[model samples]
Each structure stands twice: as structure tokens, then as C-alpha cells.
Target: MTYQESHFFIWIAAAYLLGSVPTGLLLGKLYGIDVRRQGSGNIGATNLYRTVGRKVGVMTLVGDCLKGIAPVLLARQFGLSGEQIAWIGLAAFCGHVFSIFLKFKGGKGVATALGVFLALSPLAVLVALILFVLLMLKWRYVSLGSVCAAAVMPLAVALLSGGRTLTLVTFLIGLIVIVRHLENIRRLLAGTENKFKA
Candidate 1:
């Protein structure tokens, strides 16, 4: 393999390791709390916010977002093509969804996926963010907004960038996010899903 080819695995490995850092759980541990047991048994930002605090939750969001953005940007800066960057992003997203350190259990990959798409197609990500915010404002259900925004991500990426590979990556990210929200879907159906409080 060429030098660049050899470094591909390095970048991917680095991304996965960085993404696998369970920011929420670590933060909760710092405060002597098991956030997973407190709220929704999730290690994502939302669960952190609900169980920990807004500050810790924001920190987790930033940390998780960086995990997604750092590797893809680094790969791109090293002159990797769109497809390679996409793979790097996917590796990071997968790390979040199935964290190695968490014994293959982790967050829903929402913030990490946000960071990935922000680096891949910022405009598309911005549009999806707007959709997510609007939905959240209207329904107060972060899960519903996440599911719908993920569902819209591929269309946004396609329309804004016309990137076949990026669209494919976004679609897969969306699918994983939706699947992760299956429990929320069940709760929504049963009218037992929690709503965000002002």
C-alpha cells in the first residue's frame, strides 16, 4: 500500500477511538452519578442534560461533536477525497453509536453525526438543524425532531451539494439514528414519551 493508503487506517482508527470516548458517562462519573440509570439509560447529550445538568450536557455535546469533526477535517486536510472523508465520518459515528469502551453500547450518534455532516456539508447540516429546532419547538420531543431531521438529512445533502457519496453517508447515519430511536418511537406511540420542559 502507498503511504496515503497506509495512513487511511490510521485516520480511521484515530477517529473511532476519539468518537468512542463516552463523554456523558465520564462526565456523570465525575459527579458521582450514573446518568444511564437516571433518565433514559442513554449516554447522549440529551440524557446528560436531563440527568446531569445543562452545563455538563453542553460539554458532552461539544466533546462528541468534536470527535466527529476532528477526524474528517484532518483527513480532508491531508488531501483525502470526499469518499475517504465520508468513511472517516462513518467510523466516528459508529464509534458513538457502538462505543468500544462502553462494551459496544453508547449514544444515539446524533451529535457525532451532526459533527460529521457539518464537516461534510455544512449547509445541508444547517438546514437539518433548522428542521430539528423547529420540530423541537413545536412538539417538545427531541427524539421526534431527531428522527425527522435525520430522515430529512439525505434530501438536504442531495439538494444542497449533489454529492452522491455524502448523501449515501447521510442516509446511513439517518437510518442508524432512527433505529436507535426505536424505543422513543414506542413511547411516542404509547403516549408515554417525555417532553422537554421550559
Candidate 2:
């Protein structure tokens, strides 16, 4: 392959590897908890918070978000094209959703996707965040908020940034997020989903 092609693949691989880090699982281990075996059986921040502690959950959130941000920033620093960077962001989100380290199992890509869009288009992220917050405040269901925010992201990106590649990637990431929350959606519909506290 040519140098540019090779460089791009390397970055894609790196971003995926970074995204697959399983922040909640590692943090849970540090505290002698295996988050995957705990509440909701999820390695995402919400499960971490409910199963572990608030601090660990928050840490996981930041770490997963960074996994999304770092790769995009590095791609930009390396002078990658916007389309290439969009792909890299998607790679990062995919990693979190299908982590190699976790035998291809991973968490919902909410926080990580947030990081990606925050890097690609802060305005879109802002709009999504407002939606998330409003839903959270009104319904107290984290899953509902996440699903709704993710559902809104593609349109937000298209309208605010006008980057077709970025919008498509965001749409895919948002779709994945919604898919990963299928169980939660069922629970929400059944009125049995856990509500976030404080």
C-alpha cells in the first residue's frame, strides 16, 4: 500500500484499539468489582455508577469519552482529511461497542459517541446534550435520554456542520447506540427500567 493508505489504516487500528479499552470494566476491577457481572450487566458509565460508585462511574464516563476524543484529535493533528477523521471517529465508537479486549463485547457507545461529535461538531453535541439533560430531568431514565439524544445527533450534525461524511458517521454511531439500548428500551416501555438518582 502507499504511505498515505498505510498511515490511515494505522490510525484506524489505533483508534479502534483505544476505543476498545473498556473503561468501566478496568475501573471496576481497580475497586474489586466486575461491572459486567453487576447491575444491568453493562460496562457503561450508568451501570458503573449504579453497580460501583459514583466516582468510578464518572471516571469511566470521562475515560470512554476521551477514547473518542483522543483519536479524532490525533487524526486532525496528523493532517488527515475530514472524511478520514470521520471514519476514525466511527472506528473509535465501534471499538467501544465491539471491543476486541472484551471478546468483541462492549458497552453502549453513548459517552464515546459524545466525545466523537464533541470533537467533530461541538454545536451538534451541545444540541444533543440539551436534549439528553431535558429528558433526564423529566423522565429520570438514563436510557431514554441516551436513546433520544443519539436519535437526534445525525440531524444535529447535518444541520449544524453540514458535513455529509460526519453526518453519516454520526448517524451510524447513533444507530448503534440505540440498538445497544434495546434491552433498556424494552424495560422503559415496561416501566421497569432503573431511574438515575441524584
Candidate 3:
């Protein structure tokens, strides 16, 4: 295959690998505690923060976010089409949600999803951030706010893009985000979910 043709597979694989880095696991290992075995028994930034401390949690969040951003940005450097970019975003999201290194079990993909959308559509990201803050502050529930923010992403992209490929991609990403939070939703419904502290 030509170099241009080969970029399709190369980009997807690279993005997936980037997404599968497992920032939470690395942070937990750094602290000598398996974060998955601790609070929430999940390998996400929130659990990492609850298990370790603010510093480690912050680092994990940054790493996870960067993973999504980096791959898509790199793909853009190759002058890919909008559809290709959307595919890159999807692959990256899947990698984060089902990382290969983590036995195909990974985080809820909120932060990583945000990273992809943030880089691909900054305006949508800004709107989602605003919604996230409003919901979180009004309800004092991070998961609720996060889910609402994710749900708004596709709408925001639609408003910004006029139903382009990015719109559909954002919608799919938003749905994936919600699906990843199913456990949190169950906990929230049962009133057993813990809220984040200031």
C-alpha cells in the first residue's frame, strides 16, 4: 500500500496504543497500591484520586487527557479528512474504554473523551465545561455533572458544525461516554455514589 493508504491502519493502531497507556494503573503502581483494589475498584482518575492523593489523581487525569489529544492531533498532522479524523477519535475512545494492557478493562473514558473532543472541537469542549461546572455545583455530584456534560457534547458539536461528520462522531462519543458511566448511574440512582469534595 502507498504511504497515504497505510496511514489508516497506522493511525488507528497508534491512537489505540496511545489510549491504552493506563495512567491510573501507572499512578497506583507508583504509590505501591493497586488502585483497582481500592475505592470504587475502578481504574479511573476519580478513583485514583480517592485512593492516592490529589497530586497523583491530577497527574493521571492529565495523562489520560493527553493520550486522546495527542493521537488525534498527530493524525491531523498527516492532513487526514474529517471522516478520518473522526475515525481516529473513535479508535482513541475505544482504546481508553477498553485498553489492551489492562485486560481490556479500562476507565469510563470521560477525561479521554473530553481530550478528543477538546482538540477536535474546542467550542464544544468549552460549552461542555460550562455545563459540567453548572451541574456539578448545583447538585454536588461529579458523576451527574459528568454525564450531563457528556450528553451535551454532541448537541454542542451539532450547533457548532451544522451536522457535519464531527457532529455524528461527537454524538457517538457522547453515547460511549454515557455507556461507560453505567455503573456510576446505577450508584447514583441508588444514592450510593460518593460525591467529590472541594
Candidate 4:
């Protein structure tokens, strides 16, 4: 393979590895808590915040966000194309969702996808964030907000970035987020999902 092709693979691998770091799980361990065995049994920031403490949860959120942002920024610094960067972002998101370090299981990929889209299309991310906040304020269901924001991301990217590759990647990431929240959706439908307490 050419040098560029080799570098692409290297970046993809690095992104995946970075994304698979399991930030919440690691933070929980530092506090003598196994996030996977607590709360909703999720290693995402929300679960960390719920089971651990707000500090650890915020730390996990920042760490996971960096998992998405770092690689995309590095790829851009290395002069990779937008399409290539999108794929790298997707790789990071996938690693979070299907973490190799966690027996191929992981969190719902919301914050990581937020980071990815923040890099790829900040306007889209802003729009989605607003929708998320609105939904959360109105319904108090984090999962519902996440699912709704994710469902809107593709359209937001399509309208703002106007790039087919970015839109497609965003669509895939959003789809995965919704899929990962399937249980939450069921609970929301049944009025059994927990609401965020602030």
C-alpha cells in the first residue's frame, strides 16, 4: 500500500483504540465502583454521574468527547480529506459503541457522537444540542432527548454541512445512538424510565 493508505489505516486504528478507552468504566474503577454493574449498567457519562459522582461523570464525558475530537482534529492537522475524517470520526463512535475492551459492548455513543459532529459540523451539533436540551427540559428523559437529537442530526448535517459523506456518517451514528437506546425507548413508552434529577 501507498504511504497515504498506510497512514489512513493507522489513524483509523488509533481512533478506534482511543475511542475504546471506556472512560466511565475506568473512572468508576478509580472510585471502587464498577459502572457496568451499577445504575443502568452503562458506562456512559450519565451512568457514571448517576452511580459514581458528578465529578467522575463529567470527567468521563470530557474523556469520551476527546476520544471523538482528538482523532478528527489530528486527521485534519495531518491534512486528511473531509471524507477520511468523517470515517475516522465514525471509527471512534463505533469503538465507543462496540468497545473491544468491553467484550464488544459499550455505551450509547451520544457524547462521543456529539464530539464527532462538533468537529465535523459545529452548527449541526449546536442545533442538536438545543433540541436535546429542550426535550430534556420538557420531558426530563435523557434518553428521549438523546434519541430525538440523534434522529435530527442527519438532517441538520445535510442542511448545514451539505456534504454527502458527513451527512451519511452522521446518519449512521444517529441510527446507532437510537438503536442503543432501544430499552430506554421501551421504558419511556411504558412510563417506567427514570427522569433526570438535578
lDDT for each candidate structure: 0.91, 0.94, 0.86, 0.93
Model 3 misplaced regions, further than 4 Å? 1-3
Off by over 4 Å in 4: none
Q: Cα miss at 59, model 4 (Å)?
A: 1.0
Off by over 4 Å in 1: none
- How many clashes does the backbone of model 4 have? 0
- For every model shown, what is its TM-score relative to the native structure? 0.96, 0.98, 0.94, 0.98
> What is the per-residue lDDT of model 1 for residues 1-21, given as tens digits with 9 covering 90 to 100?
899888888888888888899
Question: Which residue pairs come into collision in candidate 4?
Answer: none
Candidate 1 TM-score, true structure as reference: 0.96
Q: Give the range of the ten consecutive residues with the poorest summed lDDT in model 2.
A: 162-171
Clashing pairs in 1: none
Q: Which order, best to worst by TM-score?
A: 2, 4, 1, 3
- Candidate 3 residue lDDT tens string, 76-186: 887888788888988888898899998898888888998898789899899999989988888778789889988998888888855578888788878888888898899
Q: What are the per-residue Cα lDDT tens digits for candidate 2 across 1-198?
A: 999999899999999999999999999999999988898899999999988989988999999999999999989998999999999999999999999999999999999998998899999999999999999999899999999999999998999998788888988998999999999999999999989996
Better of 3 and 4 by lDDT: 4
Cα deviation in Å at residue 95, candidate 2?
0.8
Error of 1 at 66 (Å): 1.0
